[model samples]
Each structure stands twice: as structure tokens, then as C-alpha cells.
Target: AENARLRAREAGSLAELEAMVAAFDGCALKRTAKQLAFADGNPEADIMLVGEAPGAEEDRAGRPFVGRAGQLLDRMLASIGLDRSRVYIANVVPWRPPGNRTPTPQEVAICLPFTLRQIELCAPRFLVTLGAPATQTLLGLKEGIKRTRGRWVEYPGLVRPARALPMLHPAYLLRQPIDKRLAWRDLRLLRRALDEEPPR
Candidate 1:
């Protein structure tokens, strides 16, 4: 498994990484998934958003964040004057887990390399991990979303270090609409970060 991850990490380009993930058979989720939801949006964007896994809509469309959650995500991005076109979006687990259930630890472990490599290839200046799985998986943290959201940390896993922020998933906001305020606060913080003038 480590060798596979190493190979993926060494991929020279985003296209190669995508191809590797598509051909990867180490994870079982791929067998049940309709297609590989590799990523969406501009690969060269400065902001990269990582989600937990592909939902039904995402699996069907072979893109991340295309369901009701995706709609909310779009609105959230719009609030900050950004959109999918300005950000790269992918998932920790590119395939959809059965019954829309949370992916098992083993599944995440097997698929981790592809996502890490995707990030390295995209090399975004800002990284946002949506939901707990994505936050923990990419940021290497154990805290839950309630404790981790709205905080800023540096992700060292990428080819170059990046400022990372964790936030509530849009699906969670859909279920608990009141928590949208917290998400709103996080979005504002992100906007401020993006708007900040880079140090000379």
C-alpha cells in the first residue's frame, strides 16, 4: 500500500494522478461506485476544497459537490465572491460509499494517496476541508468539526505548505439550518484570508 501511495505521490502531473486513481483497485468502494469522482473546477485555482466523499449525485455525475449539498456549497462560495470556477474541488474518497454511508477507515486509508497527490498537483495556496473526515484525513488532526472548524492551520502534506481551514459540510448545514451561521462565519474568515494582501 505504501508503495502505491509513493507511486501516486510521485506522479508528475494532475492528469497522471487522475488516471492512476481511476485505475486503482486497492479500495473496495470503487467496485460499487458508478464512476470515479476525481475532481471538479479549475485545477490551477488558488483555493482547493476537499470533501469527505462523493454523494449519490456526485457519484452519478462523477464530480464532487453536485447534490443539494453542492448547491449550498455554491451559495456559500458566492457569498465570498467565489465560485466553482475559481476553486478546485475533490474528495478524500473519490468513490461513493454504499448507501451514502460514511466511508470505512480502511477505504479512506487505501484512497488517501490519490487525494494527497491531487493536492500536491493542484498546489493551492488555500486549502479547505469540508466535514470531519476531510478535515482529519488531510489535516492529520483528530478533533471533531465542532472543535476544528473556523480555525487556521498549516497543511504540510502538500508539495508546498498551504494554509488550511476546516468547515462544516454543506450537507450538515442542509440538515441543521441554524448551524449555517457558523458556516457563514467561516466563509467570512476565508474571504478575509483570500483578500489579504500577500506579504512582500
Candidate 2:
């Protein structure tokens, strides 16, 4: 009964939600962005991946995860029997921050709710936060992604009850190839979680 209600709330059809988000004008990043790179992928997938903010490539392409870092993410998902086509992907801040610096708290504040609503819209079984900012925002923790990645944590306060698996972002991976191995391990962990069935 509870599960059925949850599905109803997160039912397919992000049209209304997307429309609402498109009209949002709180975040300052929106002022300087080319376009709102809302989200890209299967809306009903079991996994939702969230990044921090759009970079040059994302701003120009109007899509998250399209640059070199995104390429690495594509390859990572493919390595684990998954791809963007089968998962939900988006950023906390849809627009690129000027100079590509970390978003200010106020910027994240306005946009975080948008992404949260997005999670409600996508309704993924699990959330894979893709960087320090993403992880910290979702989990409300001050710990670094290194201290938190690859572990499953229940998020009851979120719109949907879901598990979170924080991981190093692909952008970071490009900066540190040796860290790619760590991301690979997190992917394996995600695969294992996906293979499990909910307890009845």
C-alpha cells in the first residue's frame, strides 16, 4: 500500500514539474547562463545522478555531463551495464557559475529545491551524488566525498525514500586518473544495490 502511494507521487510525467522549474528565477547563476540544462535521461530509471553545477561544455551544449568529464561518466556507466539512457542525470545548479567556481550557498539554496523536485519527478530507487557539493547538499553533511562515497544511506526526509551513494565526480577523475579506480569500485557497489530486491 505504501509503495503504491509512493509510485503515485513520483509517477511519470515531469511536464508540470519541469514547467515550474523553468520559471524559477531565484538562483543567480541563471542570470549568466546560456540555457537551463534541466535533466537528461530516463525519467523512470532506478538511479538518479546529480552533479554540482554546469561547466563550459554543459552551458554551451545545454545538457549536463557532455564534456570530457561527462564522457568519462558515460564510459563508467557503460562499464557497469548502464548508461544515461537508463538513468536520470542533472545538476544541482542548472546554469554554469561564472568562471566555473563553486556555487555560493545562496545559489545552491535556490536551486537545491529544484533538484529535489526533480528527484521526486524522476523517482529513482537510489541517488548517486557525483561530487562533494552534490553529496553534501543531499546528505546535509560537512564530510568530504572521500569520507562518504560508496556507502549506502537512507534518506527519509527527501520527497522519496531512497538510498544515496556518493562518488567522485568524473571531472575529478580526469584530474586524477588514479582516482578512477575508486570510482570504478563505487560503480560496482551501485550495481550490487541495483541487483537486490526490496524486502517484502
Candidate 3:
């Protein structure tokens, strides 16, 4: 909903961007969504994390990863000495897709510009994409989440040494508990990548 494009053009600081995002109402997602669910955690965190979109609870609560999936995410991040307050968290689409369904390409396109502006404003050192939708869209990869998760790929268009590590979505892990182990492995790999280099 934020004027992401204008923010990109004129943003000089994080405070300014947050103020702009708090007032934006461009995307259609804002029409049905209870809240914008703009972002969570430290605005200046070194690590920036992205997820697919808001789910049922997220839609109601107006925050990213704040449901059961979010609880699991917190535990996973704690395993590697990270948490929301220490790392910035957001979503590819700012609003919840209807009925919590996956966002269509048209929806993604509408929101992409704003998200790009957010990244440009935040400028995190490491990038992590949660779940297939986010990884596929962010990396523009045709590969499936199974094939893409845990594989290292460089995120495009950034001023930092950004590495995008795709991991299983917590919602998926809730349904497929067996895959939680796989997600753990992916998290470890993320830890390693984060350790590879400091912010540039």
C-alpha cells in the first residue's frame, strides 16, 4: 500500500521509509486485508528476511510470520542465535492473497516495485527467502523449492554481498513435520553463509 516507488526515489533514511510505508495504500491487497502487515523487527537489522505472504492469522493480526508458522520461525532463528528483533523481516507481497492462497504473478508484479524499494531502503547484508514462493520469485528461478532450498544463490540488485538462502516455510513444516529436519539443515547453511562475510 505504501508508495514504494516514490520512497525508492526520495528515501534518504530508514525513518523516512517507515513513515512512507505506514501511509501507503496503493496495492489492492489493502482493500481486503485487515492490515498492511508492512514489516517486523529492527528497521536497521543487518540481515533481511522475506517470506511469501500473510496467512489467516497474519491477515488478522497485520504482521508477517506471527502465527504458528511464526512461532516455529522464532525457534529456528534462536537455534542460530537470531530473532526477529535482530533481523529485519518482511514479505514479497505486502498483503494477504485472497483466502490465504498463493499470490498470482499480476499481484506479485504490482507489489514487486514496493518490495524492491524496501530492500533498497533497508540494505541488509544477508538475504533469506522463506518458502518456495518467495525464493522462486525473488531469484526468478524455475526450480522447485525442494531443489532450491539449501542451494546457495546470489540475490540480484543490491549494494551488499547478499546471499539468498531458501528454506522450508514454517507452515509447510507444520504440515510436513518430517521436513522440519530439512529446514534445520537449510538454517545451518544460512548460518554459514552469514558467517562468510561481514556487511560490505
Candidate 4:
């Protein structure tokens, strides 16, 4: 964990961070994963969305959110007048755990510094944490997504604080289409928040 922190601290820019993550070997997931599933979208975007980890398609593509779930996420963003061009997206764990298994606590601990650093560098105004794992990890909430979703919390960013909104993951919504209504409500909330901002 100390090594991971030191390595993450060395990155002064997103490019450097990506390079560091690519070369980092402290986490065992790096050994089994094919490539680093780094972030995608405009770095200067006002909103940043984070998910749990890379899936098979994301791993194969070396980009976060490229599978069916990703497609759904894209549509979800579009629903609120946003897209990859308007927001930044990444995952808590860059590598795909073997067989898409949940990453162990040790693995999350090892990679968390990098994730935090990534957010620091981006410094978005609004942060959307998708699914329970991301919301719990980033926001330090113990409750499940059902209970925590749609509420706004402050993310203690290293650079500037961002208003974080926890929401159901697109994958979960896929499994439970009826729950999409809840997701729609959250989307409307995000849209309202975005609209509330005064013109820059």
C-alpha cells in the first residue's frame, strides 16, 4: 500500500498517472489483466462518473465502459444532455478482476490512491458514483445503493471538493429494468443540478 501511494504521488498529470498505472505492479490484478482500462472523455469536463471496475469488453478495449453497460451509460448521459465529450468517466479498479469477480479489499486499497489522484487531477464540479461499490468506496457510505442512491454528498478531493451523487449502476438497471425509473429520477436530479449552475 505504501508503494502504491508513493507511486500515485509521483504522478503530476493525467498522462503521468496513466503511465504510472500501466507500469504499476503492486496490485496483483495488473498481472492477470491484459491492459489498463484508464479513463475516457474530456478531462476538463464539469462532471465525472466513476464505476466499480472494468468488465470483459472494457478490458479487451483498454477503455472503461465499452460493453453493454457502457452503451446504457452513454444513453443515460444523453438523457441529461451529456455525453463522453461532456463528462469524464473511469472505474475504481482499472483492471478486470479474473472472471469479473469483485476485487478484494486489499486490491481496492492498493489501487485507491491512484483513483483518488485521478479525481484530483480532473477536478470536476460534480461526481457521479455508479453502483454500490463505487459509492461506498468513494463516499465511505456503508448503506446499500438502494438506500443511498439519489443523495448528494461531498467528496473530499485532494484538489477541490465535488458534489457527489450515488446512483444505481447501469448493469444493475439492466438486470432490473423496472428500477430504471429510479435511475431516471436520479438523472433528472443530475440534470437539475447541472442546470442550476450559473453560466461560466
- State each candidate's clash count: 0, 0, 3, 0
List the candidate 4 regions with Cα displacement exceeding 4 Å. Answer: none
Candidate 2 residue pairs in backbone clash: none
Write the candidate numbers in order of decreasing lDDT. Answer: 4, 1, 2, 3
Clashes of 3: 3
Candidate 3 off by > 4 Å: 1-7, 18-25
lDDT of 1 at 27: 87
Q: What TM-score does prediction 2 earn?
A: 0.89
Each candidate's TM vs. the true structure? Answer: 0.96, 0.89, 0.89, 0.97
Better of 2 and 4 by TM-score: 4
lDDT of 3 by residue, 1-200 (tens): 23466555676776666566556666677788887787888878877888999888888887888999899999999999898878988898878888998888777766776677677777777778888778877888768888888887888768654777788888889999999889989888878867886655
- Choose 3 or 4, whichever is better by lDDT: 4
Residue-level lDDT for 60 in candidate 2: 93
Most lDDT-accurate candidate: 4
- For each candidate, the alpha-carbon lDDT, in order, equals 0.90, 0.81, 0.80, 0.91
Q: How good is model 1 by TM-score?
A: 0.96
Pairs clashing within candidate 1:
none
Query: For candidate 3, which ten residues in a row score worst on lDDT?
Result: 1-10
Model 3 scores a TM of 0.89
